[model samples]
Target: MNIRFDLRQVRAFLAVASTLHFKQAAETLCITQPALSRLIKGLEESIGAELFTRTTRQVELTVAGRLFLGECQQAITHLERATHLAQQAASGDIGHLSIAYNDFSINGVLPSILDTFKEKYPDISVDLVYMPSHTQHKALLDHEIDVGFLIGPLDMAGIQTFRAALERIVVILPRRHHLADRQQLYIEDLKDEKFILGTENGWREFRQYIFNICIKAGFTPQVVQEASTSSGIFGLVAANMGVSLYSDCINRFQRDDIAVVPLDHDDYSVETIAAWSMSYTTPSFRLFRELLESRLGGES
Candidate 1:
């Protein structure tokens, strides 16, 4: 009566209540009969109620025991269910994740990664945001987005970058262009041709990468026009406004007015990285990273 009671008492009481026998309940609970008896006595005394009636040959629940039993069973069930949900959350099996992506990533590697990830962890609710790399960088910094699939090198502080895909730069020219019939085009081939490119916000680092590629090819490209959207870039190229360089992934969106040709250069590939705040650590983010990394490896 003077002893403290806790979940141990509740468990012992449940076992004995279910079996209506101390020796048998002790066996089920892996405890000594004496310990089980003490636990039941303490729980009864602490609650100021006799939960069971005992005789020389019989044990039966008291009226109070019958009523309390249902609630106790519910309590145990709820506790077990809550524990399971917590474990799932810790393991990245269930949660919400906000992922920011660029235009090229949406068309290319992101879809496969998302499909595989959703198939494996269907409980996770994902919010996809279409944004440029520069905007995504700021969102990552502010913790607005969980992660970003964008072109690199981000070269920013407080951000961790993982290589998600190696995207090859391809040439998108008008179907009737003299070079359209060529199987593959080199950077040198486009040196003299006018270029259609994304605006600064659309691809800051990637724009520089493109410029470097042209510079590496021994000539500066003449960017005669700029388009903010991928579809707009295609429209510009289709109209014969200028030829453009885009990720090989864009070939999925085939246009009859445009000729998609692969680039034949050693440095034709651009590295697309998964970027996140270095300080932010979430199981959902880790799960996404692992799945994306696997998808990227399979792609290569």
Candidate 2:
């Protein structure tokens, strides 16, 4: 059986139940006493119970009314909580954000940005994932992630980008290597050296940048081995496997076995960009982007 009632009836019952005086409850609800009485009568009829004992001198709840008062109070409390949460979500105060990042970003500026964001909006949940620049482009287009910090010069339809960091290309060498002692070296000096490079899967865009710079420097690097991650590449170079060209962001780490040497070339630099899909957006993501923009001094 369907017992039909409405919020107005529940509220009226609560008001009357609280005050135990029809005139006072009616005044509290901003309604006439006759209108308040009609609402109560309709509610009692719908529930098929006499909810109140009425007399000229006093008003009291029946046993059924006492039980209902408890349940009604809980229901109203829950409804109010739901309303508050909905408002918070709409304002970007409490929600979840999925972020994708690559080597240059995670090792450099992304952590500081995230820390500040969390401090300001503690209720917003953030999930960070490791992805390459090429993969992040597709993921953003497919709406798989909210934002991505990856290799720069990203030009694609339906995707927006911001340059987050501009790091000069540097060479990593074994500590015992002859050139490691030099204050700086040119890209041409590495033409004859064995290079440990990142593999095509996660380093496609960055590998292209390295190749372009090397070609400009009058020689192509001789790749002796390839690794899939930054740590792996660093490990290979540290173990004396081969030298590699990478962004200066690697300096953020403390590794005694490897030397980070600056390149003399002034034109070549690696860019870390933050990208998002224009077609997909959320309040939480907007807040995240706003924080990024503010930190970057409104640069896009």
Candidate 3:
């Protein structure tokens, strides 16, 4: 037979079993004694068993009632836990988020933002994935990631974006380079110098920015070597492979072999932006976005 009992019937049975007194169980259930009795009678009938042996002086559980009591209590406990977890999920307190970041952002403010978010919502799981800026643009559009921190001004239809950092361009050169002694250098000064840059696959957007700045400076960069990551680029620069134009975020790293000098032009700056698709926001992502909004508001 199909079990046709409802929560109220289960609760009424539990209350009566706990008290062993009909009047007390009725009071515990906040129902009239007659109503409580109807619930228990319906529950027992549905289960095909007599749950209690009623006496004028005392009410006692039958063998079936004793067995039902233990299992019923456990079921109620599990149900309550399920309800609590569902509530937490709805309130953005527990969930999972896939977040993408590029080299520049992971080395900058993204870490602090993630730390603060994790502290606030300890149960929410965050998976950080490294993705190039151009790849992140596609990932955001395809709903593959919840958020992306990458090179900015991501003007796309369905994607929302906000500037996360504005870093001035700087030159990273070998310490012994002739121009490294200058307090500041202009992009034009690097026109004749060999450069070590990131490869086009992983650093296409950033490379484009660098190329544009150099082109505006009236000369193309002489790329002597290409590295796939920031560390590789730094290692190449340290070996005197070439000097590279990069964001001032290089200051965050301590490298005795390389000098980071400010670029003289005010027109060029590396902008990092946080991007997300409005269509793919989950409860966890909403919480993170709210935190980002508050942080951005404070800065503004």
Listed per candidate, the RMSD to the true structure in angstroms reads 17.5, 16.4, 16.2
Model 2 C-alpha lDDT per residue in residues 1-300, reported as the tens digit of each score? 885999999999999999999999999999999999999999999999989999999999999999999889877865774576588779976787889999889989899999999999899888899999899987887667889999988889999998788889899999999999999998889989999998999899988888888888898888999998899999999999999988898989999999999998776688888999897787888999898888885346
Predicted candidate 1 versus true structure: per-residue lDDT over 61-87, tens digit per residue? 999998888778867865764576588
Candidate 3 displacement at residue 293 in angstroms: 2.0
* Candidate 1: regions farther than 4 A off: 1-94, 297-300
Candidate 1, residue 10: how far the Cα is off, in Å: 44
lDDT of 3 by residue, 171-253 (tens): 99999999988998878899899999999999999898889888988999999899999999999999999999788888989
lDDT of model 1, residue 117: 87
Report the CA-based lDDT of candidate 3 relative to the real structure: 0.88
TM-score for each candidate, following the candidate numbering: 0.65, 0.69, 0.68
lDDT of 2 at 269: 86
lDDT of each: 0.85, 0.90, 0.88
- Candidate 1 lDDT score at position 273: 82
TM-score order of candidates, best first?
Answer: 2, 3, 1
